[model samples]
Target: MQFTKLGAFISLFSLISASALTFTLGAQEKSCFYIFTEKPRTSVNFYFAVQSGGSFDVDYAIKNPKGVIIHSDEKQRQGDFMINADEVGEYEFCFANGMSTFAEKVVDFEIKFQDENDIYKAKMPVQPNSQPNTHVEGMQTTIDNIDSQLDNLLKALQYYKTRNNRNQATVRSTESRIYYFSIFEVLLMVGMAFLQITIVQIFFKGSRKQLV
Candidate 1:
């Protein structure tokens, strides 16, 4: 349950993002990711957010190792879920963009595997000891607090990063629309000016003929 090296701790968490799926009329696109639990009753943390694309929403589903749906949602922009892995096998997490047309979706997701012992230790009350090792107990408590704070900080940073990316994508899309609209407006004005000049010239010729 204890990890001595940072690499070992990092290995328990998996961060995977699907490539952008370009949606077309009557086209259905789905991305499925899998993570395995080596032990039963492992705590799995699932976090996801739609970073960009149309409506900033996507459908998601999670299935157990037996291929039964455990959780699902439609047109969700973001979610954070914790699942208890009772079965020891690969679990499926999927994203579907079938309902969208002419717009692609970009999704950011993370799956974290945590031992049940750690979860329980954090939740369970500590029993009093008549002659407990004061120094060791104090050190352990401090370490646990630090670890919990770091985990929370990491989540916060990731949440902000996703928001920033989504906002930037929105700005770029708006800029593109504005650029094309300006061009269309300029062409419309030029066409109107040409039509007016032609009409004025025709009127002047008619007046000259009538006067002559």
Candidate 2:
């Protein structure tokens, strides 16, 4: 949650074929940026942020690495961007809220490569095969396995909940039907008894007067 300043934390570096750097803003309040690299197979990413301006609302790009108006939008807070590097080495990424505009902002950025852990391994440069010591295929395989397990777990939980809800609904319906049937039977029996009593009272009264 610490928004580190790009000026103090990171420095720019260059490499072959596109200088190994491209930056883009997000699809939100401030702006959005994207980098398309020509180098195949290998890919790298650097995350960065910056806080600038404190006045009326405005949107513009101070420096776009690609030099083609990469992104522009009105921002109320700070700006966030993600840059991609196709071959590794060093890449430069930046953001600005103009000199006199918007509210004060804070930014925090980090480099993400291979999976989250690969970045830590990248720090040891003087060592042999520090980052990709084993093989990129192996790292990708591990990531694939982890993703599969997560998907299966989510599916299993969803099915269990759906079945339980179905069972509860069936039980409720059956109980309601039985309750209504019992009430109807009791009312029918009472009606039959009342009719029989009326017929017997009229006939029996005539027989009693003749005997007297």
Candidate 3:
């Protein structure tokens, strides 16, 4: 019973350590965050999206413990990456907003770490003995199923979030263009009206002078 409780506690702790964050980057500025790993060959999942800003894109890079660039890109609106930590140390993830001089970028990102040993332990078979063993096996199976479902749900939510962000950016861009076009059209109409009035006045004056 104590062992089962301890396993449950560890699972909960792992889930809680997975993190999501949102941040704003000013034009021509860059931001970075770090995660520490205690062992080599741990699986890391990284995800990022530009929630709002000009062009809906930003530059990003992932660096290993030794400052070696593992993955990088420019003008990317969103990305999902899975990497294995080859060394035990700090890993850096950075985002750059150098593409726009005045537009700020809103970015959302998540990082999750999976320890291979924990996974192996979770999959290990249990020795069959009494009712307690059977009960524990059933509980573990249920927990695994729940964890799988949660993972799928998280993916679905992320997809919807990206779609929503893109739609919002489109709407904002269209609205801004429409506003500028309307102002230009109004100014052009006013200018044409003034020109026509000036032409009519000149014609009438010339006719009077000719009569004189």
TM-score of each: 0.77, 0.33, 0.82
Ranking by TM-score: 3, 1, 2
On TM-score, the stronger of 1 and 2 is: 1
Candidate order, lDDT descending: 3, 1, 2
RMSD of 3: 7.7
lDDT of 1 by residue, 10-64 (tens): 3333332211222221125776666776689877888888777888888889889
User: Candidate 2: lDDT of 151?
Assistant: 46
lDDT of 3 by residue, 1-212 (tens): 00011112221123234678777888998877777777788888888989899888999888898999999999998988799888888787888998899999889888887665564334535566734566677888887888789888998898898889889888989999999999999999999999999999999999999999
| Clashing pairs in model 2, backbone N/Cα/C closer than 3 A | 24-33, 24-34, 25-32, 25-33
* Candidate that beats the other on lDDT, 1 or 3, i.e. the better one: 3
The candidate, 1 or 3, that scores higher on TM-score is 3
Tens-place lDDT digits, model 2, residues 1-212: 11222434433432221122223333223432333333333344343333222332234442233354434455433333443343322223335445443344334333333334323232323456556556665666776687668746844553454345445645666798889888888888887888789879988998999999
Top TM-score: which candidate number? 3
* Cand. 3 Cα-lDDT: 0.79
Question: How many backbone overlaps does candidate 1 show?
Answer: 0
